[model samples]
Target: MARTNPLQFVQQVRSEVGKVSWPTRREVMLTTVMVFIMASLTAVFFALVDMAIRGGLRGVLSLFG
Candidate 1:
């Protein structure tokens, strides 16, 4: 088993972190807006689906009663 020197490991980690591509403000804002829009649409869709199922179950149960 080869052991890495602690000092060399710290330098390697710093170099890798510096190489990361950070997103610009505009890019971050656009991505956030898109996520919110998709989330809202998903919520609405699920709500409608749930209401439909509840209504169907109630109607079926009413018939049995």
Candidate 2:
């Protein structure tokens, strides 16, 4: 509701930023690698599921046709 002055806003932003515990470069890199690995695994899992579903549909349709 109350407007902060420009200088006060800047100071407040800096103080809040300073309070944050930023990750180290190594930690960031490790987490990034883990994320990529997990994403790849997830994609592979979905791809397999999709192939299974498609194969099942094709088999069922062939039986009727």
Scored by TM-score, the top model is: 2
Model 1 TM-score (2 dp): 0.85
Report the lDDT tens digits of candidate 1 across residue range 1-65: 97789999999999999999999999999999999999999999999999999999999999999
TM-score of each: 0.85, 0.92
After the best TM-score superposition of candidate 1, give how far the Cα of residue 7 lies from its true spot, in angstroms: 1.9
Please report how far candidate 1 places residue 31 from its true position, in Å.
1.0
The alpha-carbon RMSD values of the candidates against the true structure, listed in the order shown, are 1.3, 0.9
lDDT tens per residue, model 2, 1-65: 99999999999999999999999999999999999999999999999999999999999999999
**Residue 13 in candidate 2 has what lDDT?**
99
Can you tell me which runs of candidate 1 are displaced by over 4 Å? none
Look at candidate 2 and tell me the lDDT of residue 8: 100
lDDT (C-alpha, whole model) for all candidates: 0.99, 1.00
Q: Superposing every Cα of model 1 onto the true structure, what RMSD results? A: 1.3
